[model samples]
Target chain A: MRIVIAEDAAVIRDGLSLLLTTRGHQVAAAVGDATALCAAVAEYGPDVAVVDVRMPPTHTDEGLRAAIRLRRDHPGLGVLVFSQHIETRYAAQLLAEGSHGVGYLLKDRVSEVGDFLNTLVRIAAGETVLDPEVVTQIMGASRRTEALRTLTARERAVLAMMAEGRSNSAIATALSLSYGSVEKHVTQIFTKLGLPPSQSDHRRVLAVLRYLES
Target chain B: MSFRVLLAAPARKRAWYELGYALVSLPIAAVGLIYLLVMLLTAATAATFVGVPMLAAGVLGARALGAVDRGVARALLGVEVPVPPPFRPRPGLIGWLGSALGDGAGWRAAAYRLGKPPVAVLASGTAASLWGSGLVLLSCPIWWRIPALAHLPVNTWPRALLAGTAGAVLLLLAPWTVRAALLPDRLLVRALLGPTRASARIHELETTRAQAVDDSATALRRIERDLHDGTQARLVALAMSLSMLKDELAETGRDDRLDQARVLVDLAHRNAREALVELRDLVRGIHPAVLDEGLETALATLAATSSLPVDLQVDLPRRPSAAVETIAYFCTAELLANAARHGGARQAGIELRTRNRLLRLRVRDDGAGGAAMGLGTGLRGLADRVRVVDGTLKISSPPGGPTVVTVELPLHP
Candidate 1:
C-alpha cells in the first residue's frame, strides 16, 4: 500500500516513513501541516494518509478539519487520524461522514508496529478502524449503560472489539478464542441489545457503534 | 457671521456650564474667605489658649469644603478631580491638633480657599458684565422704545442698530473670556483636591504590576509551545526508534546476547514513552495546548477529565485578551482542584460569562465548605493574580455545605 504522512514533528515524520518503507509499503509523500497534507494526497493519490490531529498555523484540530475536507473531496481515500490525546468529539465527527475508509488512533500505537500496520492496511482496504481508546470512551459515555450491563465480561470485551470494527476471526485471535465462540458471543450481544443482526463486518461495526454512540 | 457666532455661544451646553461655574464659584469663595479670615484672626490672638487649636480646626474646615468644591467643579466645569486621602490623626488631643496643623493637604486646601476668592471674583465679574451688557444691547431695538431711554443718544434707530451689532460681538467673546478667566481656578481645584503624592506613586506601581503580569503570561505560553514542538516531539520520536530497534533485535536471532539487547531496547522505549507522558503533563501545567482552540473548548476538556463530574457552562460571545484568558483558566483549574481535594466535593459547576466588559467566572461545588483564602495559598495567590489585571476574586463558602467562588476580570489587561 502507498501512504502519505502529515506530521509537524520532523523526527516522527521521518521515523514513520522509514518504518513503512522497511515494511515493504510505498512511502509516496510525507509533509507537514494540513495544507501540505492535502497537496500531497492530491498529488500522490496514496491509498492511505496518516494525519496528525494538530498541525502548524494554529496547532488546534487543523489536521482533523483537513481530514474531514479530504473525506468530502476524495471519498475513496483512506484517512487515519493520529493524535497524542483521544477526543471523543473528534471521533464522532470523523465517523459522522460514514465510517468507511476511516481510522482514528493514538500516536502511541505507532510503537506497536504490527498492530499499527494492520490498522493502516485495514483502512486502505476501506474498513472502519477506530482506536480501542475511542471505543472505550464511547462505551463509557454511552447512554445505554443499563442495557450494556446485561452482557458478561467476555461478551463485553468481544462487543468492544466489534465496535472497533474487528472481524470475528480477528476478535477470536486477539481474545485467544475459537472463531465459533466469537460468533456465539456476537450473536448473544445482538440478542441482549435487541440489535438487528448485521451480516457483513462493516455493517456490524456501524450497527454496534451507532448503538453505543447513541 | 456675527449672528451665527451669537447663536452658537448659547447653543453650546459646555459654554452654558462654564458660565454657570463662573457665576456659582464666586459666592462659594466669598463664604470660604469670610470663614478663613475669622479663623486667622482667632489664631492670631495667641494671648488666649485657643490660638493653635482654632487654626487647626480652620484648616480642617477648609479640607471639608474642598470636597464640596470638587463636586461643584465636576458638575458644571466637567472637571473630575480625584479626592485626596482622608486625614489620619495621631492619638490624643494634642497629637490630633498637631497633626491637623501639619497636614499638607489641609494647608493646601486653606491656601486655595484664600486665593480662589480673588480669581473667582474676577472670572464671575467678567462673565456677568459681558453677558449682561450683550443681552441688553442686542435687544435695544425693542427696549429703546421705552420712555426711560428716550433721552439717551443710542435710543434712535441707527444708534440702536450699531449697539446691537457691538452686542453680538461681545456675546461671542463672553464664552471665551469666561473660559480664560476660570483657568486659574480650575488649576487650583485640581492641584489641591486630587490624590496626594503617595497615592499617585501607588497608582503608578499598580500599572507596572499589571504589565508585569501580562508579560509573564505571554512568556509562559511561549515556553510551553516551544517544549511541545521541540522536546516532546523529539522524545516521542526517540521512543519510536527504540521500539523499532527492539523489533529488529527480536528478528535477528535466538542468541542470549540478542535477547538481552532486545530487552534493553524495550526498556529504553518504555522509559522514553514515560518521559514523553511526563513532559506532556508538565507542558500542560504551564499552559494547556487545548487553550489555543479557545477557553470554552479548553474548559470543556478540563471538565470531561475531572475526577468529579463538572457541569461547565461558558457563554463568552466575545473573547477576552489572551492574558486574561490564561489567568481565568488557571483560576478555574485551581478552584476545581480545591473543590475536589480539600472540599471533598461530589460535583462542581463552572459558569463563565462576560458582562459589562468584565469576564465573570463562577465555580461552585456541592461539598464540605469552609474554603477561605486565609486557609491556603491557592485562593490568596489567585486573588493576587486577578488583582494584577484589576480583577477580583470572591469566595462564599459557609461551614456546612456548598462552596461558591466568583472571579471577575476585565476584558483586557
Candidate 2:
C-alpha cells in the first residue's frame, strides 16, 4: 500500500511514517497543515492519506476541510481523518456527499496498531470506515428518531456494527452470530427502515448514514 | 485656607468657568421648568389616554436635555458621566409608553430638570451680584463726575479715596463668592446627571466580569495547547517507542531477559494509554471543542455523553455574546455533572430559551433531591460565576425525588 501522512505534531508524524514503513507500506510523502497536504496528495496520488484534523495556522478543522476537498478532487484517493476528539457535525459533513473511500477516526485509535492498519486498508479499497466512537455518538444523537425505535436490542447492535462499515461476516463474528443470522438481521433492519437493499457495501453504509442523519 | 489660591492659574480659570456655568444655567433652568410643567400636566391627565404618548415624548425630551447637560458638565467641569443604556420600547404603543414611563433614568433626568431652576437662581444670582457690584464700586471714583453719582456723599478727596479703597476690597472678595456659589451646582450635576450609584456599580461589575471571562477562556486555551504539545505528544511518542521495542524483542526470539523487557514495555504502554485518556478528559473539562459550533450543538454533545438519559431543547432568537455563551455552557455542564454524581439522577432535562432580553436555562432531574447552593462547590461556584454577569442561579430541591435548577442571564454581558 502507498500512503501519505499529514500531521502537525512531529512525533506523531515521524512515528506514523516509521510504523507504515516497517509494515512494508510505501510512504510517498508527509507534510504538515492542510494546504501542503493537498499539494502532496495531488502530487503523489498515494493510495491513502492519513490526515490530522487540527493543523497549522487556524488549527480548527483545517484537515477535515482539506480531506473534504480531496474527496472532491480525487475521488479514488482515500482520506482517513484523525483527530483528538470526535465531532458529529464534522463526521456528518465528511459523509455528506457519500461515505465511500472516507474514514473519520480518533487519534487514540493509532495505539491499536492492528485495528488502525485494518482501517487504512479498508479505506484504500473504497470502503466506508468510521471509528466505533463516532458510530456510538451518531447513534446516541439519532436514538430518538422514529425509524430507530423499532429495532430490537440485537438488531440495533447489528445496525451499529454496519454503520461502522463492517462486512456482514465481520458483524457476525463480532456479534457472535452465524453468517446466516447476520444476513437476516441486516435484511430486517433495511426492510424496517424502508431502505432498498443494495449489493454494494458502500451504498448500504451510505443509506444507513442518511437515515441516521435525517 | 491658602491665600495663594486666589491668584493660582487653575483657581482663576475655574472661577471664570463657574461664573459662565452659573450664567448659562438660568436659561437652561427656564427651559427645564417648561418641560417639567408639560410632563406634570400630561402625567396628571394620563387617565384620559392623551397623556401616554405625551408623557413618553416628554421623558425622551428631558433625556435629550440631560445629555446636553452632561456634555456641558464634561467640557466645563471636567466631570465625565457615562451614558446609560438606551430605552428599548417593546412592540405596540402601550408597550412603548410603558417602557418609557417605567424608565428610572429618564424620570431622574426629569427630576433634575425640575430641580435645576432653584439651584440656577441661587448660583447665578450670587455670582452676578458679586461681580457686578465689585466692578461698579471699583470704577465709582472714575465715574464720580457723572450725573448718575453726583450726590453730596462723595464730594471730597478723602471720601473719593475711601470709596476707591472699598471698591478694591470688594473686587478682591468677588472670586471667593463665585467659587462658593458654584460648589452646590457641581455637586447637583454629579449626583443627578451621572449614573446612579447602583447602576455605576453594575457597570463596574459588568466590565470586570467580561475581563474575568475572557481571561479564563484564554487560559483554558493555553492549557489545552500545552497538553496537546507537551504531555500528550510525549506520551504518544513513548507508547510508539514501547510498541517498537516489543516488536523488536519478539523478533529477536531471545529467551534471556526478553520476558522481563516485554513486561516492562507492556506496563509502560498501559501507563501511557491511561495518561492519554486522563489528559483528554482534562482538556475536555477545560473547554470543550464542541462549544465552537454553538451552545445548542455543544449541549447536545453533553447530553449524548451524560450518564443519565437527557432530553435537551434549545430555542434562541439569536446567539448571545461569546463570553455569555461560554458562561452559560459551563453552568449547564456543571449542573448536569452534579445531577449524575451527587443526585444520582436517572433522567435529566435541559431547556434553554430567551425572553425579555434574558437568556434562561432550566435544568431538571429526577433524582434524590435536597440540593442546596452551599451543599457543594459545584453549585456554589456556578452561582458565583453567573453573578459576574449579573445573572442569577436559583435552586429548588426538597428532600424528595425531583430537583429543578434555573439560571437567568442577560442576553449580553
Candidate 3:
C-alpha cells in the first residue's frame, strides 16, 4: 500500500509514518496542514491518504474540505478522515458523494492497530468504512427508529456492523460467530427493517446507511 | 512662624488661580445676569405665540455659557466635570420647539447662570481686598525708604514696623480666604455642568459591557489553545506510543526488543499521566473545584499557593450569589497574580467583606505602587468584570509604596 498522511500534530504524524512504514506500507509523503496534504497527494498519487479533520490555519475543518476536494479531483484516490471528534454533519458531507473509497474514524481507533490497518486497507480497496461511533450516532438519530425497533438485539448488531461497512466475515469474527450465522442475522435485519437483502459488502453498507439516514 | 511661611500664599500657584478665577467671574456674571433677567421676563408671558421659542433660545444660550464656565473651572480650578448629554431635539419646527423647551440640562444651566452674579461679586471682593491689603502692608517697610514717602508720619520706624507685622498676619490668611470664596462657584459648576445620573450610569455600563465581552473572548481562546496544544496532543502521542508497543509485543521470538517495548510502555504511561494533569489544570482554569466548597475555601486554597506570602481574611454576613462569588474569586486571583508579577511585591493581602448587600474584595501588596487601570496589566479587565455586575473597582496606588485595589460587587447580581 502507498499512503500520504496529513496531520497538524508532529507526534501523531511521525508515529503514523513509522507505523505504516514498519508494516511494509510505503508512506509517499507525510505533511502537516491541508495545503501541503493536497500538494503531496497530487505529487505522490498514493493509493490512499489519511487526513486529520483539524489542521493548521484555523484548525477547524480545513482537512475535511481538503479531503472532499481531493476526492472530487482524483476519483480513484481513496480518503480516510481521522479526527478526535465525530461531527455528524461532517460524516453526512463525506458520505454525500456515494460512500465508496471513503472512510471516517476517530483518532482513538489508531490504538487498535490491526483494526485501524484493516479500515485503511478496506478504504483503499474502494470500500466504504465508518467508525462505529459514527454508526452508533447515526442509528441513535435515525429517522427509521420504528423499523429499527422491530429487529432483535443480535440482528441490530449485524445491521450496525453492516452500516460500519464490515463484511460478513469481519462481523462474524468480531461477534464470535460463524460466517453462516452472521449471514442469517444480516438477512433477518434486512427483512425486519424492510431493506432489500444485498450479498456484497459494499452494497450492504450502502443499503444500511441509506436506510438509517432516510 | 517664619516669614517664608507667612508669605507662602503669594509663592503658591493655586492662590493665583483662585484670584484669577474670582476676577474673571465678575464680568462674566454681569452679562449672564442681564440675559437671565430678560429670559425670566419672557417666561412670564409663556402663553403667547412667540414665548416658547424665545425661552428655548435663552435656555440654549445659557447652556453655551455653562460650557464656558466649565472650561474655566477645569483650567483654573482643576475641577473635572463630565460633559452633559446634548439636546436631542426632533426634526421640524414644532418638534424642535417642544424638545428645546423641555430640555432639562438647558433649564439647569439657565438656573446656574441666574444664581451666579451675587456669589461672583462676593468672591471677587474678598479675593481682591485680602490679597491687595496683605501685599501693600507687607511692603511698607521697603517702600518707606523712597524719598517721596520719607516725610510721611506713617513712615516712621514704629509705624512701619506695626504695618509690616499686620501685613504678615494678613498674608498668612489670604490662601484660606480665597479658597473659601471660590467654594460656591465650584459647587454650582459641578452640580449643573455634568451629565445626569442616569445617563452617566448608562454610559459607564456600555463601556464596561464591551470590555467584559472582550475579556471573556480572550479567555475562551486561551482555553481552546491550551486544550489543542497541550492535553489533546499529549493524549494522541500517548495513544500512538501504546499502539507502537502493542505492535512490538505482537512480534514473537524477539528477546532483544523486549526491553524496547518496556521503554515504550514507560513513555506511554508518562504521557498519559501528563495529559491527565494538563486536563485537570484546564478544568480548574474554567472553574475551580474548590469553589463548590464555597468561596472562602477557594480563596484560602488560592492564598496558600500564591507566589508571594498572602494574608487572607474573609468576613461575610452571608454568602453572595454564585455569579457574584465567581466574579469576586476571579478578581482576587487576578489581582494577587498581578501583585506578584508586575507589582514585584514582597507580600500581599486579600480581604473579603460583605456589607449593605455589597461584596467587597480588597487586595493589597507592599510593592512598587504604580499599578493602574487601562495599562494592559489586567487591572482594567478586572474592573470590567466587576462593572458587568454593576460593581465598582477602585485603585489607590501612590508611587513608591503599597498598591491597594478594591472591587465591590452587588451580592445579588
Better of 1 and 2 by TM-score: 2
Best by DockQ: 2
- Give per-residue CA lDDT, model 1, range B159-249, as digits (tens): 8999899887788888988899999999988887777788767767766876887788789989987887788778877877887787788
TM-score between model 3 and native: 0.55
Clash pairs of candidate 3?
none
Candidate 3 — which residues are off by over 4 angstroms? Answer: A199-203, B1-78, B82-182, B190-217, B254-413
Residue pairs in collision within model 2: none
**Stretches of candidate 2 above 4 Å error?**
A143-156, A168-199, B1-12, B40-67, B78-115, B147-165, B191-199, B254-256, B296-319, B327-388, B391-408
- In angstroms, the error of model 3 at B135 is 20
For all predictions in the order shown, the interface RMSD in Å is: 3.2, 3.3, 15.4
Ranking by TM-score: 2, 1, 3
Worst 10 residues of 2 chain A by lDDT: A137-146
Docking verdict class for candidate 1 = acceptable
By how many angstroms RMSD does model 3 differ from the true structure?
18.1
Flag regions of model 1 displaced more than 4 Å: A139-160, A175-213, B1-115, B118-195, B302-313, B330-350, B363-405
